[model samples]
Target: MVGLMSGILLAPSAATAQVSDGGTVRQLDQLSQCRAMTDDKERLACFDRASAAILASRAAGDLMVLDRKAVIARKQSRFGLAVPTSEMFGGGRADEVTDVRQLDSTIKTASAAKAYGRWNLELANGSVWQTVDALTFGPSKGDAITLKEAPLGGYRATIAGGRSILVKRIR
Candidate 1:
């Protein structure tokens, strides 16, 4: 009992644990302890220390806290790929769509570019993106590609030569 109490006392001011929610998990026990303090100055100091500790933990990658703005931005960034994202928006809101993500890749095989129709692209990142729309220009090997959200919840990828194509992430 003494060891546990001592450990708690020595622990950082603001502590958080991983939860299913997308927001930061706050430790209530430490917060309650600070509230128990009768002195106003001591309570304030305790809260300040806790806040600092929480910030440190976040910086250390020990915790993840995302706001609504971040969620919306990520959703926009990932428009065509079917990546599951339930916790990014928290509670998997009914109105929020969690089945899209953007992908950055490079042309691995130059043979796929020869076809004027659907061209398969093997990205340097190992994910594959294919052009869903008709392909006019052929992309050379090692072409830099950027896949981003397009209007109407579609994804468009632009190649190094400023040639754009409607692509879908297959992998």
Candidate 2:
């Protein structure tokens, strides 16, 4: 550990990982440095000191090592697909909603229109949107539909160049 840490400290080459302090790995290259000392007594003392330092650092809450699996799972749970770095990466936590807009989904299965009555539409993403008011016009399978937040509350469903109705997402 000393030798590895020494080389990192000695060599200024950039490392891929950054610590919480915004500093890259900088430390002794390996324990060989202490071994290289000529006196056996001094070498033993040096090794003891390094061991104690490692333990002290651990006790001081100065180290955190995240395994690859933890990072992979964090990234997966955060980003939906492809994991675009521009929007989801870097030092920022992307938990903010940047816009209020329509939630679009493909109509997978739709209940038969009740002729001047409310109807039902099941989206591909498993959201069931049913009309709350009269639905004179209805959607068909494979139609791209959008549900936008209504002014007061609830949602309004509409298809491209089609009629819109007050719809609510049940599931």
Query: Which candidate ranks first by lDDT, i.e. highest?
Result: 1
Q: Which candidate comes out best when scored by TM-score? A: 1
Question: Can you give the TM-score per candidate against the true fold?
Answer: 0.48, 0.43
Tell me the spans in candidate 2 whose CA falls farther than 4 Å from its real position.
1-93, 97-100, 112-116
CA-lDDT, candidates in order:
0.59, 0.54
Error of 1 at 155 (Å): 1.0
lDDT of 2 by residue, 1-171 (tens): 332221111112223332324343221222446678899999898777756654544454443333334444444333222334223323333212222245666899878555467777777767676778875556678988877767886678777657767886555
Give the alpha carbon lDDT tens digit for every residue of 11-128 in model 1. Answer: 2333334332543245433555787999999999987776676567657665445444555556545444566454434343422443344556677864454446778877675667
Clashes of each: 4, 17
